[model samples]
Target chain A: MKKKLTQFTAYFIIWLLLTWSLHFQEVMVGIVVALIATALTRDLFPDEMIKFLNPVRLLWAIFYILYLIFYIILANFDVAYRVLNPSLPIAPGIVKVKTGLKSELAKTFLANSITLTPGTLTVEVVEDNYYIHWIYISTEDPKRQKQIIIDRFEWILRRIFE
Target chain B: MSNPVAIFLITVGVIFDLLGCLGLIRLPDVYNRLQAATKSVTLGTCMILFGTFLEFGFTSGGIKALICLIFVLLTSPTAAHALARGSHISGFKLWEGSKMDKLEEDKGK
Candidate 1:
């Protein structure tokens, strides 16, 4: 009975705090809603053995975000310039790129990262391998392009999610 | 300087989005369609959402617009690629204009 009470109180406190800070017109209302919610579905987000906050992974995630933000800005400028240019200097091609991340989540993140960059699009991913269809493949050599993507974006994804 | 500019920007975005959807429908094959949709949709949605950002400022609606933009950026091509790859593996040939299917030759391992 004591253990059950402790669990309830713990959940109630967490919910109250999250509601208190993340969204609230009034602190008292937030607390009431959180408490009511806690009373209703107290076991919704059952406590996992591993806490959501893993410090090392979070640090790496921050680094990845910063890197991606910088790249996004660069890519935006690059795309805008190419669009405005009279020559239409785009070398469109379907290039297959490889990714080396071991986890599905990592692979997904890596694939998404590639697509998120303005000039490239992820065309396929079967198992661990990725096949990209790029707008301007800067290089004809598939191996070099694969290596570059894996080194830059895939590596960052592995750090962040894995 | 006015709501008309906003409407114009939104119209441009909508045009791009329509082209993207049209490409998906009209293209001869899946790979080509994926290409058309991914590029057009990314640019289209980003432009629309960016216009929203400018219009609404950094309020909840603007933040949601930003989030939607981020999601589209990260997910659309990933999904399209997954579909293309599954088609490739299951033996959906590229459009006849495609000079070669390099992947098939690389297969048989």
Candidate 2:
């Protein structure tokens, strides 16, 4: 019951953000739509997702977005430079990096961050390990690879989700 | 529409998009190409949407552009990851110049 209410609230808030109207009719309609949507998708909402409602977590999430955007811009410039270089200097490899994040959501977020930032593309996740297709394999040491890739975002995600 | 900052951002976005496509052709293997293309293209599209938001501040169109930006940011990497995993599992070999294959090695264990 609590989960359903949370889901409904989320849906309704999204509806409000989309419509951005305070009219009573729109509000009533959004409630109805959100209730129906929540009823249909009650089982889809994971229990852990409720952590997102915490204001601290929300603030951390916003900060994480800013952090992510910074890395994304850096990633774009790095790729652009490589693409424009005549020799096309790349040391492509599939390297493994381990994540300390326990929750599925956090792991997914970490993997997505790795894919968007730097020259790494996450190919697969096995247990706690992520198989990353690295455009530039900076070092052969596995510990260093994990440091370069996962450490940057894991602590922040820990704060947001864990 | 007449906003200079918006115009500048949109122009930069288009240039990045062009470079991403060029990467698609020039990179040796599927993974390398995916790396280059997805990174630049996602950033490009987001920048273009952000420019739209700046051009039409707080209006319905601007809000929609912002929402679209968020959706693109969330989905593009997921799609790229899925494609990379699918291609690798389907026996698409990495390029000859590749250094290591930890995924294949893991399979042997």
Candidate 3:
């Protein structure tokens, strides 16, 4: 019941932001839609959503998103440099790395972050082990590769999700 | 549009978009093409949408642009992941200069 209410409130707020109108009809419609949507998706979200309601976690999540934006810009430049270079410098290969995050959502976030950043695309995740296809094969040692790929994003995500 | 900054952003976005498309054609394998497509194209399209938002301000068009920006940010990488995983599972080989394939090693073990 509490979880459903929180979900409903979150959805309604987003609807309001997207609609950006205070008309009575609009508000009522937003309420109805938010309720139905939340009810439908109630079981989809794990208890993780409750943790997200905490203000501190929410702020960290926003900060992490900003950090991601900055990293993404740098990543784009890196990709552009490699692609446009005359030699076409690329040494593509798959490498295995392990993550400490236990939750499904956290793992998914890590994978998506890896893919969004340049040079790394997650090919598979079995247990805590992830098979990532990196455009530039930096190091073959799994320990070193884990430090290179997962360390940057996982620390922040740990605070937000774990 | 009228704003020089907006026009410049759009121009940069288009150039990156073109480069990403070129990568798709020039890259040797599916995974490589995905790398180019996801990073460059995602940045390019987001920049384009942001420029449109700047050009339109807080009007309905600007809000829509912002929504599209968020939507693209959320979805593009997931889509890329699905494609990359699909290709990998389908036994797509890495390029000739590839150094290692940990996925195969894991399966063997």
Candidate 4:
């Protein structure tokens, strides 16, 4: 019951933000939709919404998003440079790297981040190991590759999710 | 829009989108092309949506643009991963100059 309420509240807030209207009719409609949606997807949410609702975790998550945006911009420039260079410098290959993030959500977040970043696309995730297709095959050592890929984002995500 | 910042952002977004298209044409293989399309196009579309948000402020259109931005951020990489995995599973070979195929090795193990 509590989980359903939390889910409804979250959905309602998103609806309010998207609608951005204070009209009573709209608010009522949003409440109805949120309730129905929450009822349908109750099992979809993890049991503990408390972790996500923590103010400190929320703040860290925001900062991590901003940092991710900065990294993405840098990645775009790097990809653009490599693509346009006359030499077409690239060493494309798949390399395996490991992540310590235990939760499924955290692992998904890491994989998505890897794929979004330039020069690295996560081709597969087998257990804790991710097979990433890197545009530049800088090193064959898995530990070094883990440092290159997972280390940058994993620490911050660990705090947010774990 | 008359907003200079919005116009500039849209311009940069278009340029990045073009560069991604160029990469699709020039890159050697399916994997490389997927990288270009996923990274560049996602960033480009996000920028364009952000520009729209800035131009419209907190109005309905602006909020919709923000929603679209979030949708793009969440879905593009998933699509790319599916494509990459599908290609690899179907035994599509990497370019001749490629270095490793850890998946093949893992399968053999």
* Winning candidate number (DockQ): 2
Local lDDT at B89 for model 1: 79
Give per-residue CA lDDT, model 3, range B31-59, as digits (tens). 89999989889999999999999998887
> What is each candidate's fraction of native interface contacts (fnat)?
0.16, 0.78, 0.74, 0.74
Model 1, stretches more than 4 Å misplaced? A1-52, A69-97, A135-142, B1-30, B57-60, B86-92, B95-100, B106-108
What are the Cα lDDT values of the candidates?
A: 0.63, 0.93, 0.88, 0.90
lDDT of 3 by residue, A74-158 (tens): 8888788888888989998999898999888889889989998868999888999998999998777888988889999998999
- Location of the lowest summed lDDT over 10 successive residues in candidate 2 chain B: B58-67
Q: Which ranking of candidates, highest lDDT first? A: 2, 4, 3, 1
Name the TM-score of candidate 4: 0.96
- Candidate 3 clashes between residue pairs 3 or more apart in a chain or in different chains: none
Over B1-109, each residue of candidate 4 has an lDDT whose tens digit, in order, gives 8899999998899888898998999899999999998889989999999999999999999998999999999999999999999999999999999999898789777
The parts of candidate 4 lying over 4 Å away from their true place are: none
Q: Each candidate's TM vs. the true structure?
A: 0.58, 0.95, 0.94, 0.96
The TM-score of chain B in candidate 2 is: 0.97
What tens-digit string does per-residue lDDT give for candidate 2 at B50-86?
Answer: 9999999887788889989989999999999999999
Model 1: clashing residue pairs?
A123-B81, A124-B81
